[model samples]
Target: MGRHSLPDAYAAQDSGDAPPRRRRTVAIATMLVLAVAAGTAAAAQSGLLTFSEPCDDSAVRLTMAASPDIAPAARAVADQARENEVKSDGHCLYVEVVARDSYKVADSLARGDKDPDYEVWLPDSDLWLDRAKGNGDGVPVAPGDSVASSPVALATVPSASRTLGWPGKTYSWAELVATVMRSDEVRLGAADPSRSATGLLALASIGASSDRQGGDSDTRVAEAAKVLAQRMSDGDAHVLETLALDSSGAEAGNPRRNHAVLLSEQAAFAHNADSAGSGKLDLFYPKDGTPLLNYPYALINEPELTTTESRAALRFMTLLRNEDSRRVLAQRGFRTADGTAGTSVIASAGGRKPQPYDASAAAPPSPAALQETLGMWTITVQSARLTTVVDASGSMATLVPGRGQSRMDVTKASLIQALTQFTPNDEIGLWEFATTLDGAKDYRELMPTRRLGDPAKNGGSHREELAAAFAALQPVPNGATGLYDTTLAAYEESLATYVKGKFNALVILTDGSNQDPRSISRSGLIARLEELADPERPVPIIAIAVGPDADREEVAAMAEVTGGGGYQVSDPAEIQAVILQAIMTAGQGGQAAAE
Candidate 1:
């Protein structure tokens, strides 16, 4: 943690910059009461800093949800506060920021179930303040410096995208949005509104755009939700929480696989900078509007509060605003309050620059316009049909050196780990392929997309049962390859049986090329696949190749043809990574433009 100087809300309040006098009077009363008691007043006036509440010596706990855009800033602030506290002979403030998705956090606040002792609350949008208003005992959140005056905007990867840019200067919002809607390749990413500020902003932007065209924001939000629902079905997008950027990227919360994501500008900037050498991501700013993620420092005010913690919070605030801390924030791709850096950092950090952040601008969609837009909003998410096609062929028996394990063993282990990623709402089934299916048959009879909790369900179980199944997996003896037949069987079974489900996807993990003599030729297979997909209702097929023997070209073709993707992984360690990516990307609403 690096210590830096930040503006104090107390000071701002004292300087008459706070809300109305009535609110200021309440704040003053609260401060006086907090400073009154014997030991408390002595500690406050004496400048002795210590926590009023019990905190582990190793950690300064905080409750913050969905502030990826400000993590670096928050970190620097915490570090600098600890250092400043030490100089004043105070205990170290071990900052523990609880990262949740914007939607969950907002809901927690709405339900009044979130922790209330936090010294700071960094929200992705002020919408949360409205949600949290009547639920907490804290001072009213009637708009502050932390809330953005204008809504944030949507963004895209600049290199591959042809839309975006200002109207007249480039293309109008109508033209840009129309372009995106028509192209399957022009995939878009936004945070889940329920979990991320960026997601909320994206929703607001959609509403605003629709309203501009004579629709309602709420309806637009719902309509955009439908687009998301479809994308999720198609394996093109993932709805992960805000802070999963580094740990999981776009695959954080997705039950299926996805490659693109929606994050706060700050998070995106930080991620791009962290991946500067990789050059794999780009940012696109929707000209309409985006969620304004505003970070505000808060403190618990119950009678249990202590003077030490309050001072510590103030000290932390100072560190977050210090010049060095500001620099750290700039390095992570955000503009600081002190005007310390340029907005170009988004691109410099490896992502494309988005629309400028105008601190004083109005919220997206004027209040009067929001209603019309709400009517046009769209949101739809349905139960999906998912299948896991595993290769149990003898070739999987080969051992990889560095992993110190056979490829088959590793693949099974990875599959087991990936299973934990699924939620109860997801429909799952499994199939093992080799020269023959179980019971000496060419294709085994495994359950298809059954509910996870039923007794008859082999697909759903506690970790113990899942682990047992994984441990028992092994290639069958004296079997010839029937890869093609098995794939066809799985796909046909899902399409025929799970027709009622809104989305269907087949995940195939293979270590070699198609070897079944009965399997159709590559071109022939492509045509048949097209005919089966029924352009009106496409089913995505994600293929993961395991080793050098895997057919990269065939795998890519399968994904491209089926509106999904084929990812190659020579090492077992890459299985989890590749599978997660494919599920998120392919499961989302729109597919990549035919490439």
Candidate 2:
């Protein structure tokens, strides 16, 4: 009845309930504790469970690492399949389901740092599938069939939703999020983008939301980044748990209480159910569409799995696709792949409404955007080491007649605006260059590269030092450009002190060609760059040539040698646009990709 009742699933499928332990704020920590305990218990029971007789090696033993939200339903399905004697090549199939965080599973598979030890992974969304494959070329990750799916939504109580003028007024995804972001009246909660799909997808939406034309306009992704940096919790589940635990240190019905969270529709439903079916936790679907958790089933068919184990994993996958499993999954609050409603058997899964199964409902981001956005949230929050070199030649003083400002002034303002894009955890230093400024060296390190919060050589935070140095930057009187010498020094210094994990690079902004007559030739510099550049420790040079007279060709050539890029802007006012583009491409090697 359920299968035929509805037949439309645009995105993916879901499993069972949101784990009870995860209902509290300590969900991530608690899951870790459980994983350690579960792993230990599993190891102790491993020997007898894998083999039939004392010498039996005929059985196929596989570990199934399911996402926490869907693990219980998957486990139930596995148990029933095992009981029904699911077989692969005449061998008994053993599937041991362990609930692991999707982010942990994805990162491990991506880096290959540790053995994931599982034949298959069932993360909440298909986003991880792209991420795992992105880790490396040799990664043998392949997508499989998803059993259940759910889409993310803005979760809030009725009073809070009403207070924000929800029911009477329809809101677009951008409007809803912008309201949450700009208004102090509504307290918003979200999981860390680094570790949660809901959080990652939410940020991606916020990032892409402003790419289009708008009304009552909110700040673009730049503003969204600042808002998210300040508002996000340790993790997604943690934020939800906090709201449930202390209500943000306010009484439950208080007007000033924390109001909303970006969560899955199923999660909001389950939370409402736990609240005695009060429908206190309401789901607000953004009319513009939302990101769905497609339940990507990734099969691990690499050096880790034997031929028999791989076959068994596939067989179990086929078994999970059967009608009975769908029924069981449906009762656990998930729709079947074809968009069937949950059964009445689930008393606490809250109301069942048909979910849209289309791109508009669950817009999957491209692989590049996903990685860049995460990098924006993490590597930048806990980001790279960069050295910014500015050309202070007399030519920089030339006024751009249109904007009624000097090129140097416009460039400085652009640089300062770009500075807001990075967090204090990122390390950056400043340097200025002109002929004969450093006694024939042509460049002087105004600030040493260090974490933005570190006490710099000149005192104050590294950020403070850099800002002050940039502000005090004056065009050297009668100064000539010294591009070649400064670039080589900056490159060598960046290489010598490259931070091991973070993206390490140099940013060069200039308005003219190298003018130091005694500096290294273009030929020699190219040779040295080719000889020293290592793909393993990439230090790209993000170069920008301002004005029509700048050596665009030479700038692009230098950037290419170091696996970076160059941008040329004839107008000084567009320097801000170039700065934003440079920030995105700084250590990204031109295009943003998985690191």
Candidate 3:
């Protein structure tokens, strides 16, 4: 998990600035050829690089959108490449292992806007590969070891073993899954396929395993996704990732955030079987062993490169897989990629050996049977309402690295990008919180409103207003950090008072730590939010913490209470986009529940 901390300021400090123009010197024709080229190439006479594969030998710029979760491993690979442990052409191997969410990775590849110097892209799952192929440019290759893997079995803490079925018998993969689903307490946990690799793979596994009635497996998968989403639509709900369903709730921060992403056997080790713990996490392996996702390593051949840069990247990736690195990973509750490393509890208890993991053995569900008999399905569940909340506090004056722009400037640019995702039927409102109008008290008010009249009808032109607001935003610094207070205010005063009938939401963006506990205590916040929402009629609130020590737990609680989730960004530049997406997604979920 990414440490929820904001970075320091940089060169510029302008609050509202237009998005910086990205200058790519590559010829358009060259990019087209690269897009259309195969993933192999014959021997190169220049001897710069040669591939027996059919990919074109031209400078293929492969951009693997590395999730923050797996950056350590990706950087480790880069380190190995630098030390010659893993070899590749520096000139042609342009790998941009970015910290982009899975959806963004798919979008960039699908649109052909992403030019990777490397041909291979290792996402969390192979679903995006299918979508990419549908767009004509199939995934070129899947390489590298599993970055993270865990047993997808029934898991209970050592403390709860007596209560839960810890030493349960080895049921078949289908039987175990079916059995789990049978229990009200045994809900499945996985990331949403649209946004997460684990989610997509899990959906694909369900589709590939089961038989579809009238619709294709894709349709079935979509339906199952909806069921999973519904189960997770409430604050108290927890989907089993790897831990037991009971292991997650509003009280357990990490578990609650990762309620839906458990590991499959394929990720555990070099081989596969069904051991005791492994049985709990039965593998719903694809018919073709789940199309492998290629994880590529690129050695930057940039003119600005330094010896340290190369060393750092290579050392980091190698470290990720090294025994020490594995230990670090396990300490953070992440599964070790190397099977031999086994499992270790996040916090050791009196020097006891950490939990043991048998990566070699797994209980894979019958691929053919799964293909023949699909169980549940999922859907996009997109249609909903969204509200964007901005923090114009004094701290917003800080700057972010790389872009040499202020946090506020980058926020505006990112918000503008987010505006592009809304539909007319999606009602949107904005609010800002700080000290006071005349420096007396903390307050929040509706800045603007955009009525997305009807999805069945034409959408209004509120995107421009949202974008303008983002651009016009200034650092309205003042008395206190009223994020929680103002959020409550929005739910009570704004949404309840003005936006009466429609679904309501708040995407609160803040860079500073929580200063007003009275406004947002864990218990009080959840209780207050509960009062605003009915069990059947739920609303969502997404909180984004941008600065160091931004009180992620409090924000997460707010999200959890409102049937949504929380996101923390270390980089201020990513705040606008991330927060907006959170708002939009929460709104969508809220609208679905209301309906």
Which of the numbered candidates is closest to the native, going by highest TM-score? 2
lDDT of 3 by residue, 27-73 (tens): 11111122212332221211134445532343333444565445555
C-alpha lDDT values of all predictions: 0.51, 0.67, 0.45
**Top candidate by lDDT:** 2
For all candidates, the clash counts are 87, 9, 61
lDDT of 1 by residue, 524-582 (tens): 77776777875555567888888988987887786677787888888876776566556
Arrange candidates by TM-score, descending. 2, 1, 3
Q: Candidate 1: where are CA atoms >4 Å away?
A: 1-69, 86-95, 114-119, 134-153, 162-175, 215-223, 232-262, 276-278, 288-290, 301-303, 337-341, 349-595
Candidate 3: where are CA atoms >4 Å away? Answer: 1-381, 438-441, 452-460, 493-504, 516-523, 576-591
Give the clashing residue pairs of candidate 2, or none: 10-357, 12-149, 13-148, 13-149, 14-148, 14-149, 25-241, 191-236, 379-383
In candidate 1, what residue range of length 10 has the lowest lDDT sum? 20-29
Candidate 3 accuracy as lDDT: 0.45
Q: Of 1 and 2, which scores higher on TM-score? A: 2
